[model samples]
Target: MKQYCQSILIFFLGLNLAFAQNKTENVFIITTDGFRWQEMFGGVDTTILKDDKFVRNRDRIKNAFVGKTAEESRKKLMPFMWDTVAKEGQLYGNRWAGNKVNVMNPYWFSYPGYNEILSGYADDSINSNDKMYNKNITVLEFLNKQPKLKGKVAAYSTWDVFPYIINDKRSGIPVNSGKDLVQGNLTEKEQMLNEILKNYPSLASDRHDFITYYLAKEYIQKNKPKVFFLSFDETDEFAHEAKYDEYLFAANTADKFIGDLWSYCQSTTEYKGKTTFLILTDHGRGDKIKSQWTSHGQKVSDCYQIWMAAIGPDTPALGEVKTEGQLFQNQIAKTAAKLLGYEFDNGKPVGREINSVKN
Candidate 1:
């Protein structure tokens, strides 16, 4: 009789575990550092393309990005985002359409912008891109602490400071950033990737965005993390170098990477109907007309302006929210947490989850 009762209990426990796994939702947050909303919605800025100071080969730039209309040009640059994401999800921060999204950080730069994004609040003390460890808890850390997601959360970033920003040592989350060698038992393909990364010529001080994307994809395929974050830095680096052509190219390539990620999630059984993607940027650059397009700081006008897009099982296919109200970057953390069926309470006041994505 005891043996029979033990068998029954085991059966019930199995059922409960299965139910929990089925209810688990995945969230992937992707950020392109310093990418502007203007080019995101309107496509390559022709004004900057024509300026000899920014564009070295005006005709080549025109042929590559310029079209008869802004819509055509944008589509040409980011066909997947303009075609699939716009049709299947929601996009915000088109200032001309009166939909605005801005960062809450007083300092319009990488660390502060990223902190506001992950922590659900801006820290005035974190004003620089220093290597100091983040004091406040991030949404990623909160998710990592959950029973279902512990040891199943990972971050891959092009910038090296991500370890400090996410406090990887304290959170105990695997962070593959900068030129750090890929660790763990990697698949053959992933091993090849690591070998290539080691041999590839140095394009930027940080690892290339392609390496970051592939490494994150490999990790996702191997470990199937419940939550993931990928940050690409080429856009910001190229812009700061005043290489407009390379910036546009990098932006287009990043769009392709995003499309590929969405496709992979939809094709995989674990994430097919359960994954949500929140795509955004840390901050926006200055105006092209002001010749400060390559810069973003407190002194730069419109530097706070940023953009966000979401697509998933929970988000409605609203496509380009043009409402009058403004959205802040801090809201992203709560919105991401809400999508994964968790409340991101960091024991402090923060922005609420975005209403549009709270279905």
Candidate 2:
């Protein structure tokens, strides 16, 4: 009888241990600034490809992204996203298919869009992408304050304005932004990366996306933050410059970076089987026609339409969601919190948690 009781206790203890392991969920929120849903889902618009004003080297652009069909083209552009994430996770905001994901902010600009994404609401006052500090608390701030997550939340962004947008001073979260030297002890590779950052030419407004990606990846490998935000901005910059070829290249490269990050997470014990990745854009740019593809703001129609993709243990492998429904960008904050087994309440009226991503 004593041996039987001992066996039952051991079984219950195993169950408890499993539960604790499950609770240690890691969340990665990544964004590509102003990346339109058009190229994301449909791939390089043929109209833009033929337009001499946008395409200086037509053959080069076509060979890189253009295929027989939209599906084939997009797959070529984002092989990891289309081949792996699409099969293992869910993707929303295919407007042609009736699924729509939009930003709540009417401004449809970078600062406002990112604010709504992180704070779960639209603030009309944050219309400009200036260096002004954000007043509202972000989901990152909320998570950093949590007992288990304190000092374990980090943000790395390519845009220089992120330090202001995230209000790093107020949140007390570590934010590494444009041209900033990496601090603290570093590995040999990290040291080399730091030297490159110092010598690399300034091609974009902020830092190059590749630099931002590598910095974030190195930090994650070393610190293993509970929650991390990696934001890339070259897509938006290239679009604004009307450099279609560079824009597509940046988008394709971002896909590869995300794929590499996902693979790394799966290979590590701390992140394997417990990490969730939420990939999205800050806002969408203009349509292919109407000569507005380079701009995004309140005046740009359809600029609010964005795309979001998720992959994790909690999310169902529904692939591309074609169901008739509308999703708002504000839900991202609550969704991130939910995936980590917590509720994000900013004490203000905000978006609800995304039910589809929860277990």
Candidate 3:
């Protein structure tokens, strides 16, 4: 009788552990390439768009500026962002703070900027005005190795070089982006779209990570991946063109996409009340407005200033606290790992686990 009682107790304990493990929430990371802190928060009081360059899209710039400080403008331009996350969790201009080095310094162009953020260490040995080719271990690689996280991590980018940024082949995680093409079973719509891509071969579809967005949303709803990394490359492309109106449109579109993702997460029981979102830029641009059209390769360039915002259930609800906590782009790897209860081994691992959702 004593042996039978002990066996029953052990069985119940095992079931309890499994239940706890299966009740995991998710973390979503989104990046807007070459996003600028100045444009995001610089008051309309001094906005160039408020003056000579003002157009239909730039008009939104003026409306975006409500109060005196950068924080105020940010709140105005992104009401949902401010009310939902920044006000309660953490939001700041990484550039105004002393995070210049890790904030895509050298103002070096996109590939290097992305590599540093992903690899978590700046490499002086590399400096090419070309796309990256070598595969480097990323935060995704580390997170995917955690117990039960395998086949649960995925990445989507708009750039052609994303295959190299993550080296998805080695990681075995599904990566979709420009020209990479989505593989596996497809819906009827997808099958039609694939046929279209082959026939026209010239028509521009929403080839950006918008497809990645759909895939991520579908996977979360179906398979429920624990970690999701999404990179929107359209804004960066428009920025390079120096078409202010186009750039603004791209930013606004990306904002809407983010809003949609948040809404979707809130509707799901597994992640509705538990998920956290981290939004950031890959690097800054130039100082002069003209040069800003196509720049970001100088260390002292004013454009190197970047911005970051986080929202979710675990972050403190302080509306817009002016705390001076330092945050580096490299810290993202550590912070994400901490939030998901995993260990990250990045070169700069001093990232604090900022509250994502209120505990």
Best by lDDT: 2
Which sections of candidate 2 miss by over 4 Å? 1-24, 288-290
Q: Candidate 1, overall lDDT?
A: 0.88
Instruction: Pick out the ten consecutive residues of candidate 3 with the lowest summed lDDT.
Output: 197-206
> What are the root-mean-square deviations of the candidates from the true structure over C-alphas?
6.3, 4.9, 6.3
Model 3 segments beyond 4 Å from truth?
A: 1-24, 43-47, 50-76, 94-107, 129-135, 192-206, 288-290, 346-359
Candidate 2 vs candidate 3, lDDT winner = 2
For model 2, what is the error of residue 189's alpha carbon versus the real structure, in angstroms, after optimal superposition?
2.1
| Whole-structure CA lDDT of model 2 | 0.88
Rank candidates, lDDT, best first: 2, 1, 3
What are the Cα lDDT values of the candidates? 0.88, 0.88, 0.63
Q: Which ten residues in a row have the lowest lDDT in candidate 2?
A: 15-24
Query: Which of candidates 1 and 3 is the stronger one according to lDDT?
Result: 1
Candidate 1 deviates by what RMSD? 6.3
lDDT of 2 by residue, 182-224 (tens): 9888888788878988898567658788889998999999999
Q: Give the candidate order by descending TM-score.
A: 2, 1, 3
